[model samples]
Structure formats: structure tokens, C-alpha cells
Target: MIRYRFGQDDVLRTRFAIAPLMELIGAFYVLRRPERYVVHRRWLKWAASRVGDLDLTLLDAAAPFGGPYWPVFVSPPPREPHATIEAELSRVRETPPERVLAEITHRYPDRLPAAARPFAGDPAGALGELVEQMRALWDAVLGPRWVTISALLESEIASRARSLAALGSRAAFADLHPSVSWEAGCLSVRPTSKSATDVNLAGRGLLLIPSAFTWPTVWPRIDPPWDPALVYPPTGIGDIWEPADTDHGALKSLIGCRRARILQELDRPAATLELAARMRVSAGGISDHLSVLRRAGLVTRRREGRRVVYARTLTGDALCRPST
Candidate 1:
């Protein structure tokens, strides 16, 4: 059990972010243990053939026996909503040499992998190589589908934020993962490992990160040099690997093909531009369809900053739900 004690300031400062490189690293775990992430088995098989040449020596050693410190260097917590892979890699490149050596030693107290031993002497040079390999792996495995992946992640964040607002922090944390709980002034995480741990926010706050690949469990990073953070699987990850299913013939007949397809896609709320890009239709066309759906009481639009996002209503949900 890991407990994070939150001070008054810490509670106010708690923020959420999306980490792309973290998803890439979690995908590696899915590749190694498909049974643990069966929902992503299809993606694992597909990514395996494509990332054959990418070197994952560092990542492999980092998680030896399921530890957290090593992967933190590769996928450090993001400070903002729009963090890019390039920016995260730059931070990894600048990590102090001593920190790298310390984490490697901690992860492999007995014997370290040959690929990682060279880093003890020259951490900077070794990290540069690791970054290049990670970039290549990202391009091969995740870059093409990042648009869809990021949208899913963003939607999860928005949902959690709503939960935080409507249901309060404790309820929101409980909903994040089955292993998470809130008690007293501390947030606790019960991970699969036997090691029991405790953390104090100390007014630094916690960063809640939503991940597409880190399913079936929540991961915590509590060590120094990185902010305290939790990485939990998002709500709609089951649909990430599966192709969009919008071929409900009956519904299609009722609403017409295009609008029915649009309604079907609203299983999750999305912005006009995002729907447009996914459907390969112009934004204007999607807007017209959304307007019609809104009028018919099948969909509703809510203003989120500059974008007006659309989501299926309860009435629309009944229409889209598979009939018995």
C-alpha cells in the first residue's frame, strides 16, 4: 500500500496531464504480457512486427521485477496538458548523471543488463542513445495513431475533471482505479506488488495522468527528482484497439447513414474538428449533422473553452445500445 498525504495547498494544486511517452512504455509491457492486457492484444501483435529493430534494452532493465524509478526517466511526468514527446525527451536528456546511475543501481541491485552498464560511466551519452531508440519506437508504434489515442486520453481527463467537480476528490480517485482509495488526508494506492509504501504531497501536489496502455492497474511514481504522480488506465481504452463500430443497420435506417454513424461515434464526447477528422468529413458537415442531432434531442453540446463538444444524450444512448 502506498499512501500520499495531501496538505491544504496540495489539494488545491492537484492537476492532471497526459503523458504520450508513458503510453509507449506501457505498450512495451502489453507486448511482453499480452494476457495481462488482453484488450490490447491486437495492438501488441501489430506493434511487435513493426518495432523489431528498435532497441528497448534500457526499458527492459528499468522494469525488472516491476519497479517504478527506471521508467520515470523515460516517461517523466508532464507539467502541462500539451506536452510533446520532443519536450519530454529533452528533459530525459538533461537528467543528472548521478540520478541515472542511482536508478539503474536500484533497479538492478544484483546484476545489471550489459546495455545499461555503459551508462554508469557516461550517463549523458547513454541517455542520448536511449532517447533516439525511443523516438524510433514511438514513430513506428504510436505516431500514426496518436490523434485517436490523444483524443481518448483528453476525453478521459475531461471526464475525471468533471468527477472532481461534481463528486469531489475522494469519489474521483475511487473511480480512477479499483486499487485507489482516499482516507483521512492521504490517498492510497494498492498496487500488485507486495512492497508497502507511503508518500507525502508536502504541498507539491500530485499529477494525475490518464494512460491508454496502462490498463488493469494503476502505477505510481514517488521517488525524488520527479513530481509525485499516478498513471491509471483511461475509461475507453477497450475501444482504442478496436475499429470504430458504426454499422448498426436499424439505427442507420432511422437516422440516415451519415447521422447514424455520427451518433454511433458519440459513444464518447468529441469536438467538431476531431469528429470531422475521424469521419473524413468537413467540419461544416459534421456541425450540420450535430445541429440536427441536438435538435432531435439525440445529442447535446457543451462549451469547453473555445470548442463546443458534442455527446450522445440518454435518448441517443438508448438508440445506440445494442438491442436484446
Candidate 2:
């Protein structure tokens, strides 16, 4: 049971952000325990072969299966709302040797495991090698699907924003998760790890991160020198890997099969790359369909960072929604 006491500043400072590395870490967890993540069965099927090719020896050691203490340097809290993998990896690469040693010591108070010896002996060199492995993992596995995953995470953040706007903090976070509760001036989170401790935000405020792979559990970061953070499964997990709607038969008849799929996927805003990947089509092909949808007022495009994402307009939504 970890309790976080939030002051006025803490409440004001609390903000939401997406962490790419954190999602990568969550993927590791999924790879380690596929049975626990039934929601990702589809993804697991697709990623199994891809994941098997990589030598995750060190990465596995860093986030060993069934452990309450993984080294913190592997996946640090994201400082930006829309963090990129490149930026996050750089942070891991820059972690001080002492910091790495401290975290390893904390995780293994008895004797350092053989796998962790490299980190203790040469944190910098080990970290560099670890970062390279992480890059390979990203490029081969997570990078391709990051677009859809990111769009899903962004949708969750938008929903949270609306809830915060409409219901204020208290009510908005009332049902963050069964393990979480907001009462009085403290936010209590019951993580699987039994580390009973209290944290005062002072002013750094908690970082609320929504992750696709952190489903069925919430991970809390209470260690010092890093801002308090809560990484939990976002809403809409069951449908994450499931086809938007295989029963879009009527919609398909109305608008060709290809266009129907593109529209259906637009339930959450997605960039051309994501649309192309999901539909197994080319970027140019998706762009053509999106242009048609945009002109028809069925979808709208807006720039988010370096990418432009498309979301369904009301007409598109109504069209996709089933009629009683």
C-alpha cells in the first residue's frame, strides 16, 4: 500500500503523459507472462516470432518475470507528454553509474544476480549495450505497431482530460482502478508489491501515464530522485487488438470494404502510418482514402507533433454506430 499525499501545488502540478519505453517494458512483461495478458493474445501471436529472434538476455535480466523490483533506469518516467523512444533511450543511456548501482543494490540486497553483475561492474557500458538491444527490439517489434498503440494511448488521455474537466480531480480519479482511490488529500494505490510507504509530492506532482500493455495491474513509481508516477492499463483494452468491427458488413456495402475499414479504425484518431499498418495497405493508398473521407466530412485530419492523425467526424461516427 503506497499512499501519496498531494498538496495544492501537487494537485495543480499533476499531469498526464505517454511513455514509449514504459510501453516497451510492459511488452517485456507480456512476453514473460503471456498467460497473464490474455488481452494481448492477438498481439502475442503476431509478435511471438518477431520477439523470439531478439537476444533479450540483458533486457530479461533487467525486468525478470515475477519480480517486484526491476531496475528503474531501464524505463524512467517520461518528462514530456508525447515522449519518443529515441529521447527516452537517451535518458537511460545518460543515467549515472552510481544511480544504476544503487537501484541494483536496492533490488538485490543479498548478492547481485549473475545477470546483474554487468550493470554493477560497468553501468555505462552495460547500459549502452542494453540501449542497443532495446533499439533492436523496438525496430523489429514495437515500432511497427507503435502508431496504433500510441493512438490508443492518446485516446485514453483525451478521455481522462474530459473527465478531469467535467468532474474535477476527486470524481475524475475516483475509479482510476480498483487498486487506486482518491480520498481526503491523499491518493492511495495498492500495487502488487507490498511496499508500504507514504510520498508527499511537495511540488513535483504525480505523473499519470496510461499504457496499453500495463493492463490488469497498476505500476507505481515511488522511489526518490524521480517524480511519483502511476502507470496503469488504459480503458478500452478488450477491443485494442480486436478488429474495430468485423460486422461492418452493412457499412461496407454502403462504402467499399477498404474505406469501411479505414473509417472503422478512425474510432480513435490515427495517422496514415497506423491506418496503413492496420489495414495492411500502403501509405499513399490510405492517404487517398483519408482525403476522400475528409472531403466528404466523414473524417478530419489534425497535426499531432510530427504526424497528422485522422479522427471520425460526427457523420462518420453515426455511420459506424449501429442503428437500433
Candidate 3:
């Protein structure tokens, strides 16, 4: 069992973040283990043809053998809540050669994946090549759908943040994943493998990262020189590929199809343009619908920075709640 010993400071220092590249890496697992991730079967079938002949042996090798030691340079914890893929890739590019070599050698001392072996001779060049390939893979497979994916991730973070505030850390961690448990100030993660491990936060704290792709299990990154983190599947991943639940027939009967969907989609606050993209409607039309909903006391609008975000009110929530 992995134990994360947290001091008072560690508890205060804990934070949450969303990682785009981490999702890309997690997608590799989904591709390899479709049976384990049945919700993503459609995505798996679609992604299979798009991934082409890209090499993922290095990522595969990084998976837990006796221990989980993913190359830190590749999947470092995010510095902020909303880090861009470009910025994270830059960090990977700037990773010192020695660090890369150390991680590679430590993970595969004798035999290495064919894709990672070349890094031993020229860590800088080979690692750079790997990063480029990762970028291409992201563009081809995930970039197009990042909007919907990121929205789902952000919604999960917001919900967890609320839980942390209202119910405290223990309740928050308890709800993170089935394999995850917190007791006596230590957070334990039981992954799919039979191996049991212990990780101590040592007052360094932890980063809770919500990922759309890392479903069915919670993945831990406890290697040294990197802030410890728990990467777990976020809620609502099943809806990522499925169509929006616009079949709110009762809701449609009351508010019309477009407005009912707008209400359904507002489970999380979103701006007009984002709503437009998700609903496949024009900004002007969404604005009109939001105006009506706001007037009817079904939705409210607030400015988040320069954008006007809309969210359903309590009355709206009651209306949208599924009938028992």
C-alpha cells in the first residue's frame, strides 16, 4: 500500500490541475485496453485508424512492472490549473538530458522498448523526436475534440473543488475513484495490477489531476524530482463521444427543443460561443434562447472576465432534475 504522509503544510499546499498531454498519454492506454474502457469503444475504433503507425512503446514500457515509474520529463505535473499543451511541451523540450537518461535507465536498466533505447545514446535528440511525434499524435487525434473534452474536465474540477470546500479533504478524496482511499492522513491508490505500493507526500503535498482518458483506474506518479500526483478518470467521460442528451422530450415539450437542450447543457457554466459550438447553433440564436431563459428565471448570466457565462438557477435545476 502506498502511503502519502501529509503534514499540516502538505494539506494546505494540495491543489488540482487539468493536463492535456496527460490525457493524450492516457489515450494510449485506452487504445491498448479497449475492453477495460468500454465507454470509449467508439473512440477506440475511430482513433485506431487515425493513430497510423505512431510508436508508443516508450509509454507502454513506462507502465508499472513491479512499480509505476513513468518518465517524469514527459508527464510532469502542471504548474497551474489550466496549462496549455504548447507550454507543457516546451517544458518537456527543456528537460535536462541527464534527467531523461536517469528516468530511462532506472525504468529499463537492461532491456528497453525499441522506441526508447535510442534515447540512451542521445537523450536530447531522441527525446526531442519523441516530443514531436507526441505533438503530431495530439493534433491528429485529440486536438479537434479538445473543446468538449476540456469542458468535461473543467466541470469535474469545479465539482471537486466544491466538495473539498464543503465536505473537507477526506470526503473529496473518497469520491475521486473506487481504488482511492484516504485514512490517517495517507491517500492510498489500488491500481489494476496486483502490486501494492506506498507513497509519502512528505509535506510536498499532492496534485489531483482530473483526466477524461484515464478512466477505470487511478494512476499515481510518485517518482522523485516531480511533485507527487494522482491522475484519475473524471466524471462524464461517457458523454465525450456520445451525442448530447437533447432527447429531453418533456423538457422540449415545456421549453421547446433548443431551449431545453440549452438548459440541459448548462449543467456547467459556459459562454455563448462555447455553447454555440457544442450545440451546433449560431451565437445569435443561443443568445436569444438565453435571454428567454433568463427572463423566465430558468438561467442567470455572470461575467467571468470578459465573457458572459450562463448557468441554470435553482428553479432551473429542479426543472431539469430527472423525475423519479
Candidate 4:
């Protein structure tokens, strides 16, 4: 059990952010143990195909399977919400050489593993290589899907913010996850760590991060030189990987077949060109349909970097339900 004692300052300082590097790390872990994370099976299948030819030897060794902890410098907590992947990777590259050696030693106190020898021998050289591998993974496997993933994470934060306003912090924390609890000015998390740990939030507030790949568990950071953070699975994450149901004949009839097909394709937030390619329709036609759907309150649109993605709203989701 990990307990975090919150002072008056701590409560005021608590904030939320979306960490791209952390999400990438979580996705890599899912790849390592796909059987354990059945919820991400669909995503695993897609990602596996994309990275089949790429060499990930270093990343695999850095984040080995079944370990209670990985190196902290590999993925330090994000300082702000909406941090770009480039910015996060830059931070990892700038980690002090001493910190790298210290973390490597701590992770392997008895005998250094053969794969981790490079870090112990030459921290600077090894770190540069590691960062290159991580960057390649991002470009090949995660960069394309980042927009959709970011939208899902943003939606979770918006929903939680509403809850915080209406029900207060205690209620928000309680609903965060089954393994978390709060009482008497303390927040407790039952993490995968076997040891018991306690932390006082001193003055720096807690950073709450919502993650799609961190499903089925919550992670906490309580080390020095960094603000405390908690990463937990977000609501409606099960649907993040599920493909759109293509057999919505009834829906197709109510809204013209083309519009209905467009709505169905938005199972996980997609852009105009993507929808056009999947449905084999012109991009202009798809945009016209999306505009009508958006105005009708069935779908909503948002810009993610250079692309504008669309997703079904609550009413839109309800309309997709198959009639009895």
C-alpha cells in the first residue's frame, strides 16, 4: 500500500496532465505482456504489424518483463499537461550522467544484467543509443495513433473535471480506480509494488494523469526532484481498441447509408482522409457528411495538431445501439 498525506497546500496544488512518453512506455509494456492486458488485444494486433520489421532489442531490455520497477530516467513524470513527444524525449536525453548510473545501480544491486551493461559502462553513450531507439519506436509505432489516443485522454480529463466540480475531490479520487482510496486527508493506492511506502506532499501538488494503456492498475511516483504523480486507467477505455461495428443496417436506413457508414467508422476518433480511405469515398463527400452530423449533435470535431478528428458524442453513441 502507498499512502500520500496531503497538506492544505497539496490539495490546492493537485492538477492533471497528459503524458505522451508515459503512454508510449505503457503501450510498450502492453506489447511485452499482451496476454495479461486482454483489453488491448485489438491495439496489440495493429501495433505488432507496424513494428514487425523494426528492431527493438534495446527498448525490450530496458523495460524487461515482470519487473517491479524500470529505470526512472527512461520515463520521468511529465511537468505539464499536453507535453509533446519531442519535448519529453528531449528531457530524457538531458538526464544527468550520474542519475543514469545511480538508477542503473539501484535496479541491479546484486549483479548487472548483460543487457544493462552499457548503461553501467558508459552512461552517456548508452543513453544516446537508448533515446534513439525510443525515438524510432515513436515514429514507427505510436506517432500515427497518438492523435486518437490524445483525444481519448482529453475526454477523460474533461469528465473528471466535471466530477471534481460537482462532487468534490474526495469523490473524484474514490472513482479514479478500484485500487485507490482516500480518507482523513490521505490518498492511498494499492499498486503492484509489494512494499509499503508513505509520502508527504510537502508543497508541490499531485499530478493526476489518465492513461489508456495503464489499464487494470495504477502507478505512483514519490521520488525527489519531481512532483508526486498518479497514473490510472480512464473510464470507457474498453472501447478504445474496439473496431466500429460495420453491420448497422438500421442506422444506415435512418440516416442515409453514407452518413451512417461515416458515423460507424468513428469507433475510435478518425480524420476525414482516414474515413475516406476506409469507406472508399471522396474526402469532400466525407467532409460534407461529417458537417451535417456535427451540426445535428451526433458527432463532434476537434483539431489534434495538423489533423482534425471526429468522435461520436453521448447522444451519437446511444443512437448506435442496436434496437431490440
Q: How many residue pairs clash in each candidate?
A: 0, 0, 5, 0
Clashes of 1: 0
Pick by lDDT: 2 or 4, better one:
2
What TM-score would each prediction reach against the true structure?
A: 0.72, 0.77, 0.71, 0.76
Which lDDT tens digits does candidate 1 get at residues 85-191?
77777887887878788877877778877877867877877887777877887788787556557767767888888887787778777777888888887898886
Q: Candidate 2's residue-wise lDDT over 74-138, tens digit each?
A: 88867789877888999989999898888878888899888888988898888888899899888
C-alpha lDDT values of all predictions: 0.77, 0.82, 0.76, 0.80
Evaluate residue 189 in candidate 1 and report its C-alpha lDDT on the 0 to 100 scale: 88
lDDT of 3: 0.76
C-alpha displacement of 155 in model 1, angstroms?
A: 0.7
In model 3, the Cα lDDT at residue 117 comes to 76
Clashing pairs in 2: none
Q: Tell me, by TM-score, which candidate is best.
A: 2
Model 3: runs farther than 4 Å from truth?
A: 53-67, 191-202, 245-324
lDDT of 4: 0.80
Error of 1 at 24 (Å): 1.8
Q: Which prediction has more favorable TM-score, 2 or 4?
A: 2
Higher-ranked by TM-score: 1 or 2: 2
Candidate achieving the largest lDDT: 2
Candidate 4 lDDT over 167-261, as tens digits, reads: 87797788899999999989999864757888888877788999988998888877655578899999888876554443577788888889987
Clashing pairs in 1: none
